[model samples]
Target: MGKLIENKWFLLLIIALTWGSSFILIKKSLLVFTPYEIGAIRVGVSGLLMAYIGIPALRKMSKKVLFWVILAGFFGNFFPMFLFPLAQTQVSSSLAGILDSLVPVFVLTFGFLFFGIRSRWIQFIGAIIGFIGAGSLMYFSEANREESQLFYAFLVVLATACYAVNALIIKEKLQDIPSLQLSSAVFSVWMVPSFIILVLSGFFQNFEASTPTYEALGYLGILTIMGTAVAMILYYKLIQNTSPVFASTVTYLLPLVAVIWGLLDGERFTIWYMVGGILILIGIYLIGKNKKPKLLS
Candidate 1:
């Protein structure tokens, strides 16, 4: 209905600003904390919050749904959460951002591969081109940087693949689960094993809890609750009413929002970003849609 579309767009606007600011917040947080610690705080807080909010619905999901939810938490959040920081330690944020743009492609491919769904070629190509435009922003002159860059790129791409995999799994296997409950359940399930390992490995003591660390934890909380949790609902609702092509437009905006936050954080800004963003936007604009085929082939 008109009400849902208007509501979803308004919610997405909040997601944009909040998720965009998360980049700057994460960058600032990384200054003092380890990546694992950040991931822990991020998912842990959001999971706890959502579990509280969606307690009844979460309790209602079948055990099979819980299994898929746990899988999503691990692949989508746990694995990627660790990979991103480890990879970023060696790779530039620009490179990581570009590589991470593979989310939609992976989502579509996984949907087709395991779920047996076919996507419209134009939408697929447009998403890929948008990724290329995002990727080009990361390219810079460096001697023989190709090998190392490619490795880090794979890690980033893998993270996005995890995301896409979760998307499909949720759509196929866990569609009966409520969005808010699913988001919280996934995070909470992942947080359990993560926290246990940190404690057993003695990484828990290393958490210094400095001012920036606390601030970063706060940002991660925001990222988990708003960006991951709330945005999950918004995106799910968007998919219900809008075509996948239009829904995927969120990908085009995410990186642009990241770039915008980078500028706001006083990072170097150049005309190339404008060009890349324009290309991505154009690609998204060209790929408008009114119908969504079943993700199952």
Candidate 2:
């Protein structure tokens, strides 16, 4: 983690593969489960899986630290877990990808507004520019021309804002916990509520997984472990290691990865898509550089 492994680009690559593909997985899972149902399972299963993996670290964490992890889970996973799937039902997977790029923008905004961190205008501008591309990509590639897409976009925005809140919470409240412990605890917390909702909602009462449904569940299961379980742990660690905006470079890279995955899978890309994607990339580059450049002493 010195000069070699812990580099920002390395972390970004990890995040790109993990979070970027999540929307694609979510699209598949939705072919069977309702958004609420998928939301419940993905978080519940991932939390349970990681809880076991992170046990020793969890035992080392203080109760005070434990609480922050729970809070992080609520904002980070719970809200977005439900929101993204619901949004995808109304929008294209590609649009979902672009919309998610706004997380860093909201993350930066929350950092300054709530945490009293000195505002970086350049960073904020970059964030906005990124969102501009993101929004355009989303708007143009929409699978549905219905008004529901607008509603879904708002929900995605809310989800991104939740990401911002989780960021500030992690920085100010959970700074003392080991990143792995924080990740485990938060994920574990998500399971309780998600399971409870799953039960109360009777989401699985019909429980019919056709072969394809079963395959979709398998995809979700893999996504739960890889995307939610493993990648989220890394994200928590990155937040601890760097500023939230720095951590949020994941947003920029992830969408491009999603775009590539979609394109390879035969999703069409138009001229507007290329133009919009380039704008988003430029915005990300600018926003990511806003952290005071570290000069070699």
Clash number by candidate, in order: 2, 0
Q: Kindly list the per-residue Cα lDDT of model 1 for residues 1-297, writing each as its tens digit.
A: 547545757655655565555556566656766666666666665566666655565577688777787786677657777777656555545445544555666666566678777667776776677666656644531111655564554666678778677666666676766555666677667666667655654556776657766776676666667666676666655544443334555665577677666666666655655565555565555444315555442
TM-score of each: 0.78, 0.86
lDDT of 2 by residue, 1-297 (tens): 555436767877888788999888988888888888888888888777777755666677778777777677789978889998998887666666766777677766666666666655677777778778766765665543566556776677688789888877987788777677777777777788889878876766878758987898898897888888788777877888787777877876777888887787677667666777677667767666665533222
Model 2 stretches with alpha carbons more than 4 Å out: 1-7, 53-67, 138-144, 293-297
RMSD of each: 3.9, 3.7
| Number of the top TM-score candidate | 2
Query: Model 1 lDDT vs. the true structure?
Result: 0.61
Clashing pairs in 1: 116-297, 117-297
**lDDT (CA) for every model shown?**
0.61, 0.76
